[model samples]
Target: MTRLNSAATAETQQSWASVLRITEVAAGLPSSEARRPATPAVVTLQMVLEKLQAGWRWVERKRSQQISAKRLRVAETISLGEKRTLSIVTVDGSQYLIGSSAGGVQLLTKLDDATPNNSRDERSQ
Candidate 1:
């Protein structure tokens, strides 16, 4: 009877050890339902520079800065009163009539923009 009891006790210890092993493995593994999807790696400026060193030309990725080409030019001016005057100014080929008085400056009207193409078209006509 003592030998039978000892055999049963050994089997119970083995079963408990197997249960502890299963618990440890389950704890170490990440849950499938809770796991997040991996995202793609982002391209950095350093990566771009490395590619450029390898003779890769970056065209559109680097934007070309636009320098201001428009300049204000007074075309014609006429006095309206003692302190008031109307001046026609051209900016980037567009003409505008501006009024200046003792109070302040005000935009009077917009005239037809005079471009080289328009002048050429007029001369051809």
Candidate 2:
């Protein structure tokens, strides 16, 4: 097997990461102005984790909690074969199993009242 240069490998990885970000942002653009193919909004692990952690931080900030005792922790990680995996995470007293795969990332289940209530605000089609 031919050996790949370390610098070349890192450069290629960086280029792909940049391309992925560009594609993500382009896809986020309005349909009329978008140059990429139409598809469902891509939700990466980073996005989901960020949203989850942000919500917690917001609540903590609102309550004027100075000490950073409460923190999101990954309790366990289980591979469900293939590229799919289940992560059990906890923050305060709440726990959730987040499923991540090539298809998408979703909350398998959560022991908390963190779900948003938007149905009452939604307008009928």
Candidate 3:
């Protein structure tokens, strides 16, 4: 066999790290526009861990090829220390939290999207 290139070795290492990273999971209702808090919201680190795990599990299920398992969207995204989120409540009320806590909106995507609260109308789909 040919010798492995440095880039290839590095890429292989990266993949393992991603696959082995612990996923945290948490629960927190979105800060509704109607219920925007005058003060900051405080959630425990434990809660954050839960949400992160859930988000990672969500991605794993999606990326997996198994047919005997399924994971539904539960929350849009859970928040990290920064603005990054680990979970999220998708339109239709199902959350679609993400595992990678690196960037993007922490708790929402679009305010206009209609959810289960609506009739799946133009409000959000």
Go through the candidates in order and give the clash count of each: 0, 0, 28
For 9-117, candidate 3 gives per-residue lDDT tens digits of 6686576445445321123444563375433333455455566566666766776755434454445444566555465544444445344555443443344445556
The deviation in Å at residue 56 for candidate 3 is 0.4
Worst lDDT 10-window in candidate 2: 116-125
Which prediction has more favorable TM-score, 2 or 3? Answer: 2
Best by TM-score: 1
The estimated TM-scores of all candidates read: 0.35, 0.33, 0.22
Tell me the spans in candidate 2 whose CA falls farther than 4 Å from its real position. Answer: 1-70, 112-125
Residues 1-125 of candidate 1 have per-residue lDDT tens digits of: 99999999789657656655554453355777327543333225334434543332233223222224437889889997889999999888889999999999999899876765899999999
Better of 2 and 3 by lDDT: 2
Lowest summed-lDDT stretch of 10 residues in model 1?
Answer: 56-65
> Candidate 1: lDDT of 91?
87
User: What does each candidate score in C-alpha RMSD?
Assistant: 31.1, 22.3, 24.3
Q: What is the alpha-carbon RMSD of candidate 1 to the true structure?
A: 31.1
For residue 68, model 3's alpha carbon misses the true position, in angstroms, by: 11
